[model samples]
Structure formats: structure tokens, C-alpha cells
Target chain A: MNLWLLAAAVLLVAAFGPALCVAAVAAPERRLIAQNLATVVGALAFLLMAQGYGRSPYRDAALVLAVLGPAGTLVYARFLGVLPSSRTVLYGAAIGVPAVVGPVCAAVGPGREMVKVLVIGALLVAGGTVTSVKGDRHG
Target chain B: MVSTVIVIALVLVGGAATAAVFNRDPTRQALVLSFLGLSLALLFMAVQAPDVALSQLAVGSAVTPLMILLAVRKVKRESTDQDGDESESP
Candidate 1:
């Protein structure tokens, strides 16, 4: 087993299973938060797997995830009519993505691949902020 | 080695699907379904198919849940409208 990829896979399963369980049972507003958290965790895991396997192409999936995760949350927030109302979770994710992605980019060194990693990190932070912000309508 | 990761993905997918099935409310089910889609993309990526994973992430996570929520809202609105009309008729 490739240890790093294995680690990523394990993290994914560990976090994802519980998050899904929580989303299934939690209240409406809380379920949305769990879903958003799962998206962030899943995106990070994808990036780790991409780095572990030395496959730049795999980052595309992560990139898609970083962009889409918040958009998905906002869609739910819109229809469900509830935003997170605080920035703690969002800020944590925004910080966490850069802390993880920066090291991976540095280890990979400067190149198109490093740039891609940075872009994904930036997108992840931006998306987290967008979704976590309190909206005009509070549900 | 590869199969181990694949097995993990399979387990996660199975668990998410089971949760989705048992949750039994369309709005909340939509959240579980979106998580299912995200993890499904992760599974595809783990099995060494980035192309498929990208497409799956693009459509499955965001679009599918939005569609489900919209459907739920429409059904809810229609039911409320029916309730409103019933009150008016008396």
C-alpha cells in the first residue's frame, strides 16, 4: 500500500462516514453545516491523494470540489433559507486549506503543478467564506 | 495495495448510500446525497480515474442536490397552495 495515499483514503473514510451519519440525523441547519464540512474534508483528501500519487491531473477533481462545495452550500442555504451566521468554521477551513496546500506546493516546488495547487487553495478559502457568511434572511 | 484504498472507498460509498436511504426526508436526504456524490468522486479518483472524478464532482455534488431541493420546494409550495385554497372554499 502507498502509505500517503492510504493515509488519505483512511482520513476520507473516517471523516466522511461520520459526517454522513451526522447529516442524516441532525437538524436542518446543522445538517447543512455537516455537508459543508464533508465537502471541505473530501476536497482536502483528494488533494492529498493527488500529491501522494504524483499525479497533477488529480488536482482537477480537487479544484472542482473547492469551487463547487460552497456553491452547493449556498444553493441549499438559499432554498433552505439559512446561512451559517458565523465565520468560525469558515475561517478555520480558509486557514486550513492554505496551511495544507502551501506545504504541498512547496514540496512540489515551483511549476505549473504548484500553481494549480495554489489556485485550488485560493478557491477553497473563497468558497468557504461565501457559504459561511450570514445572509439577509436567517432561518 | 490499490485494492485496499478501493475497498475503503467502496465502504464509504456503501455507508453514505445506506444513510441516504434511511434518512427518509427529501430536504435532509438531499444533504446526505450531496455528501454521497462528493465521496463517490473521491472513490473514482482513488481508483485512478481523475477524468471521471472531475465530471462527477462537477455535476453530482452541486447540481443533483440543487435539483432535489428545488423539487422539494415545489412540492411544499403546491401543498401549501392546496391548503390555502381549501380554506378559501369554506
Candidate 2:
């Protein structure tokens, strides 16, 4: 793939994914689904770039986003008291595992293929957000 | 030419779907908007952006519906008025 195209994809995913997710949650109706989907895709694109064509700087950037994105969302939701405190703790535990594992895998795995895993893992985290948020609101 | 036409058609369809959201009730609006996301992902794939397509699928298909359901639940809980009958005309 062309380097610039890869870069553009990464930028779009990173900038728009979380923003849309946050907006969807805040907005009424089914917008949350759109935002969540955008977030997952965006995170996945960044992950691909980080592994396939990105430099160390790109990898590092993805790492920061991976850690902070859900954390920030959880925090915002918590402050809003949308979910219970116990749920936040659970989210923390869920997020913490990959936060440690991704860097470790990147350090030791072949060709630092951790990026691909991390991207998918980030999608999983996004999934958790969906589940937890949905559970709290519904059940 | 065909590709250009397709792209234009996709954009138009996506735009119309989004605009339709405002006219519908919240639940319908949300569902339609999610379809918009699907359409957008397809468009990305059509343009040879598989990575983006995958991401869109992951988030759009999986995460978005749950979130919308949650929001809808919250609204329902807060409203405490189930009947679609309110009598204030302005």
C-alpha cells in the first residue's frame, strides 16, 4: 500500500473513531452504534498501520491511544455515573490486561506483530465498552 | 466511469439516510444511522480500503448497536411515560 494512504487512513481512524464514539454516547437515539462502530474501525486501522507500515513513533502513538481511549471513556462515563463503581473497576481490570500485554508482545514478538493483535485487542476493548455500557443502561 | 458513478451513488444514499434520521422517531433514527455506518464501511471497502472496512465493521456492527440500545434504555427509564400520547401543541 502507498505510504501516504496508509498514513491518511491512520490519521482518520485515530481522529474520528473516539470522537464519534464519545459523541454517539452523548447524543440521543441510536447514534451510539454509529460512534462505536466508527471507533472500532478507526482503532483497527491504527493498529494495522502500527504493525504493517508504521515506524516506532507510530507504534508508540497507537499504544498511547490504545491505553487512554477506553480509560478516558470509562472515566467520563463513571463521572457521569452512568455505570456503577463496580463496573468501572471491572473495566479497569479488563483494560489493564492488554495495556501490559500489548507492550510485552511488541517487545518480544516477531516483527513486533503486536500491532495487529493490539488493534484487534482494541476492538475487543471497544466491545467491552459496548457491553458494559449497554448492560448498565439496560440491565 | 462506473466506479465514479457508484461512489457518487453511495455518497448520495448515505447522505439521504442520515438526513432521514432527523425526521424519524429516535429509535428508527438510530437504526437508520447504524445502517449509514454500514454503507460507509462498504464504501470504504469499494475504494480498496480493506483495513478501514474491517475497522468499520468491527465497531459499527458490534459496538454501535449495544450503545444505542443502552441509550434508548436510559431514555425510556427516565421518561416514565410509555404511551406515545402527550397533549401539548405549539
Candidate 3:
């Protein structure tokens, strides 16, 4: 049994499943949070899958997700005109990204792949931060 | 083995799709739709189709939801504009 695959499976079943179920009935603000969190979970799962399959190219999917997930949230906030408040989401990323990506990086053992993982982690944090903040200032 | 992952993704996609149908609001439905997209992408990846998963991520995660929301916004604005002027009825 591959630990990475197990971790990814746990994430999909445990984290993403419940988050999505709740997001269904949650208020608009809560829905936004849930949706953004799902992106994080998805991206993280992709990272785990990459390691589990021993395919560096799999990480590219994670990278694309890291970049697009937050952008999608921001688009929701803009079009729907709602910005939910949640420090927990931020804190979760702050801790979760490093916690997951750090070990993966170390395990991959400093190299291009390690750097790619680190870059995806950074993108997740930065993109999450940018979207999680207050509503759009301009326009 | 991998089948477990595929099954989970399938279930989630089914749930999200049902939620999208039950939810009355276009905006919220869009959210569920986005979720469906995410799950579908996961399923694709699980099945060893990274290329399909990549395209799914782009369309499902952002583009699909954005199109729905934008359509909703446009409809609402047009309706409001019509409401502002009593002369135009319908």
C-alpha cells in the first residue's frame, strides 16, 4: 500500500466529501469558503497522486490547480458580490501546504521535482491569500 | 486498489450533480457544478488519464462556473434595467 495514494484517498473521502456536502446547504459566504477549500484539497490530492505514481509530470496538474483554484474563488466573489470571512481557511493553507508539500519535497530529495513541489506550494499559499482577503478594491 | 478511488469520485460527482439540480439559485447551482467538475477531474486522474484530467481542471474549476455566474449576472442586470423603465413591459 502506497502512503501517498492512501493519503490522497483519505483526502477525497474524508475532507473533500464532507466539505462539499456542507457547501451544498451552506450560505453564500460559507459556500465560497467551501469551494475554495475544495480546490486546496484537490490540489493536495494531486500532489499525493504524483508522488504515489512516481510521475513528475503529474505535478503539473497540481501546479495548474494551485494557480486556478484561487482565481476561480475570486471570480465567484466578484460575480456573486460576496466575500466570506474565514481565517480558518487561511490558517489551514498556511499550515497544510508546508506540512504536506514539505515532506514530499524532502522525500523527493532536492532536485527539479522538489523545486516544482515547492513552487506549487508557494502558489497555493499566495493564491489563497489573494482570494481570501477582502472584496475587490477596484471597480 | 485504484477502483476505490474511482468509486469515491463517482459518488461525489453524483452527489454534486444532484445538489446542482436541487439548488434553485443559479449562483449556488454554479458552485455545485464547479464541485462536480472537480470530482470528475479527480476521477480522470485516478483512472490514469492525466491529459483528460488537465483539461477537466481548466474547464470545470474555473471556466464553467465563470460562464454560469456571468450569465446569471447579465440576466439579472438586464431584468433590473427593464424594471427601471416602466415603458418596456415583458
What's every prediction's RMSD, in angstroms? 2.2, 11.2, 2.2
Q: Candidate 1, which segments miss by more than 4 Å at Cα?
A: A1-3, A86-88, A133-139
Q: Tell me which residue pairs clash in candidate 1.
A: none
RMSD of 3: 2.2
DockQ of 2: 0.04
Candidate No. with top DockQ: 1
Candidate 1, A133: how far from true, in Å?
4.8
iRMSD, model 2, in Å: 10.8
Candidate 3 residue B24 Cα shift, in angstroms, is 1.7
Instruction: Kindly list the per-residue Cα lDDT of model 2 for residues A75-124, writing each as its tens digit.
Output: 33432345322343235336543654465465547654555565547555
Relative to the true structure, candidate 2 reaches a TM of 0.35
Order of candidates by DockQ, top first? 1, 3, 2
lDDT string for model 2 (B1-90, tens) is: 325423542753455364545535554444445545544654554355656755665565445644765787688876755433343332
Query: Model 3, A17: alpha-carbon shift in Å?
Result: 1.1
Screening candidate 3 with a backbone cut-off below 3 angstroms (N, C-alpha, C), the clashing residue pairs are none
- CA lDDT, every model vs. true structure: 0.81, 0.46, 0.86
Question: Where is model 2 chain A poorest over a 10-residue stretch in terms of lDDT?
Answer: A28-37
lDDT of the structure predicted as candidate 1: 0.81
